[model samples]
Target: MTFLHSFEPGGVERVALRLHEAWRAQGRDARLVMGRTAGAMKREWPDLNKGGLGYEILGSERIPSSGWETLWMIIHLPRAIRRIRPDVLFCAGNSYTIVAVMMRVLLGKACPPVVAKISNDLTRSDLPAPARPFYRLWLRIQGRMLDRLVGMAPPMRAEIGTLMGADNARIAVIDDPSLAEADIQRLAAARAEARAAPQAPGRRFIAIGRLAAQKNFGLLIDAFARMAGEHDRLAIIGEGAARRALEAQIERLGLADKVRLPGHVSPLDAELAAADALVLSSEYEGVPAVVAEALAAGLPVVATRCSVSMEDMLGGGRFGLLVPVGDAAALAGAMSDIAKLKFDETAARDQSRRFTVEIASHRYLALMEDLARA
Candidate 1:
């Protein structure tokens, strides 16, 4: 069973779902277990409710994305696990793993081996000084308790080794599974269902992610404001609490006409296909699914070097440029330069082989089975 919060079926949730589907396709019993069902992601993605793959809701009525969700999971999970009886409990993130480790400590032999997936820079170095100490201590405890740690990128493994005190050899590296050719075709078909928003005739730029502090979309807006007049138009896709703040920034930048907030369009992959390039202005990530999806769609990218995988994803800065996080000037310069640079779409798509579901599924199962045996 793959356990996740499932509030927003964003990249992490989507990757977990893909792995669940892949495991089922291989004639194995795999299930997606979620804590909550009522969220904006369910309405948007709706893949879970479609009911092709095996899934179960743990009777968690309250949202698990925020608040004391970890405590709730620790209280409720043992009963759910006993009922489900999965061979191994697969956690989609550190939070889930924390619950798993704590349960193992409390319940002892009653709990199953946990394989937790890591997908970000968990070192908390990017965090505020006050919070970093607490997070570090928390990670130190959780890291020691995890049975097996799976990293989506190289950075995650290193962070786990340093922070969690896990041996380098024990940390498994599996690329995030996203955007196979068939999914893109479906996204293309979805695109044909509706007309895209009108845009100025120019090099159209696309940046996707929630309007949150982590995505640092405000930096992108600032960068675009500086460079957008040179026949560049930016469309930021996604909806979040920061919508009002972003709208204010757009107005302040005088980019109301130049930038479009299309707000969470379906077939986001197809939307990426239409743009000239993808800009990832995130403060941090571990091989973001958008970066992989963008490459699969033959779209180049200009992203912050937030994760260890950014350099490899950018083809060693050949396909695109990687800049410092939250640096608007550096991002603006890279965006301008990448727009002028040209590369073949076939070549761009070729660079995304490791992120393909087929390859990643085998890697994940191999690690899961190995850990389950131990």
Candidate 2:
């Protein structure tokens, strides 16, 4: 059983949907369990509902669209676990992790062991002034609650382990199994389209993911405005509440003609591969799929040092350029310099191998079997 908050089209949802699909491909039974909270991802879930690899969309919406639905999901999950009786339960991201752990407290021994796939590095810095210590305590709770906590990279594992102490051993390192050959082929097509793209400017630069505060796309726009290329255009894909603020910032920067917000595009491999380089200005990440997908698609990256995983993935500034988080001038300078770089396609793809789902499955399957037995 895979427990998810909702069927949203974010990285966590995408990974959960694909994980079950991958499991089904291996002739295993996998089901996606979520609340009936409607959103953009609902459109994609139907296609993933292949014969026999069916999913359960349980319960009615109590709060419909906010963080409240996540609470409802947690409350309803224990009952669903009792009904389905899955041998091992898997929680896709941080939100679902809490739900998985809470099941034991709510439903006692009836709930199965949970395997949480950690997707973000939530530190004291993420919380408000009064909540920092509470957030730290919450991290410890998460670490103690799960049967296993999965991290995307060694750095991610080490960071979380240090934060949670001995329970850190329970944290396993696994890449986001969020891509397949189909995604790669689609990216190749996008790359081809990009190579033949119409006249633009100095170079085509792109950024992917939700347009939220965490993504720090506003920072990217600021850096882009400072960049001195009349022809250099930046495209930020994906959508969120920050669209209005971002649009206003773009206009304020006088980059209306240079930057475009095309919203969320699925299989953004081509959009990524078509660009001269992919820029990431996020405040933090849990092994961002865009960075991994871009590298796999042979796209060079210019990213802020948001997480250790980002730096570790970039070979500590060897494969691509990295700047301090929120440093607009340094980010802009790196973006300007890195666009002129000719990165080796083979090496770029090779570096991205750590995040692929195919490679991640071997580790996930063994852990699942062990947890199920225990």
Candidate 3:
């Protein structure tokens, strides 16, 4: 059996890499096709090459002003599919779902069973007009061709099912995976190392994600400023296009000393374990893997009610504090409450149990077995 995984950089890439390793460990022939930042991939995962995985870089050519990249992707997808000739194709990231459908259409019987992982909530009609039609078209096509649709959260499953006109029963909820027990121990040791060092003695808040508008780091910075004198420092990890704007905001808030933007942190589990609390200030999410990791470390989370998945992940405020989107005052209040908040560490760990790497891998393998038998 062969598994061909496609994903862009970010959380999807992280999850895909983990799944790839799991499949390979089980003696399945698995390869990863990366599109986006190959440089970042090398930096973040130096061991990828040593893992015996094949990679095909896409979207590298310069095109004209008419934004021919989309055309180019559609044009080149068929060739990539034919070359890979995988027994099963797993596409990660929402941006790549349409491409996966197109490839399946081009290959027909030669193509393997395609599974598109839906990682975002699509219930909201916030998508632009042009995107709505495109999404509909892709969904209509995928509904007939794709063998399975995978989602991390129930809300994501519902949204994708509704969009594709597929039965909800056809969609599978495979929660995002967590680190192995050994890796968790390593993470704990790393946290101990961070804690043992002679660092400043103030509340340390961390926001992890790209410095992009979608992450809404600007709102996080503004919220941090509201509690500027109360907390010693705030760290925003992950770099992106909005770095300069966030830097400007930090300078404007006069928080240069209090806030730091450490770019693209590898081994985030360590940093999360050391943090006083984990903050998710995104405009949207599909059951963020980082949130699960934070909870696994027993860290209190202060997040915006960014997505329906957040409601389920946080268990309606049982595990963490949830605030309204873009509301700095409410966020400041929630951040302050972290000192007095009595969170059940066992409950947090229990909630994160569903996302274990072992569980997700087995679930996916079972699904593949069923598909093969069918």
- Shift in Å, residue 89, candidate 1: 1.1
Rank by lDDT, descending? 2, 1, 3
1-374 per-residue lDDT for model 3 (tens digits): 22222332477767777777787877877766543333355555556667544455554534321234445566666666677666677776565676677776777777778777777655434467878888677676776677888888766776777787778656898887745555555655666677788776788888888677778889888888887664468889898889999899889989988999988877777677668888888877777888887777777799988777888888778778999877888898888787677788678777877777878888888887777677
Name the candidate that leads on lDDT: 2
Residue 131, candidate 3: alpha-carbon lDDT: 85
Native-to-model Cα distance after best TM-score fit, residue 306 in candidate 1, in Å: 0.9
Q: All candidates' lDDT scores?
A: 0.76, 0.79, 0.72
Alpha-carbon shift of residue 314 in model 3 (angstroms) = 2.1
Q: Could you tell me which residue pairs clash in candidate 2?
A: 177-357, 190-270, 201-231, 202-231, 238-263
* TM-scores for all predictions: 0.89, 0.93, 0.86
Model 1 C-alpha lDDT per residue in residues 1-374, reported as the tens digit of each score? 77776556467777777788778879888877677665565654456546555677766575444466567667777778788777788877654667778778877887787788876767545798999889888877766777788887665667678887888767888877876657655544443442355654677789887778889999999998877765678999888889999999999878888888978766676577568789999988877888877776667799998887788777777678889988999999988888666666567667776677888888888887887787
Which candidate do you rate higher for lDDT, 1 or 2? Answer: 2
Model 1 residue-pair collision total: 0
Residue-pair clashes per prediction, in order, are 0, 5, 0
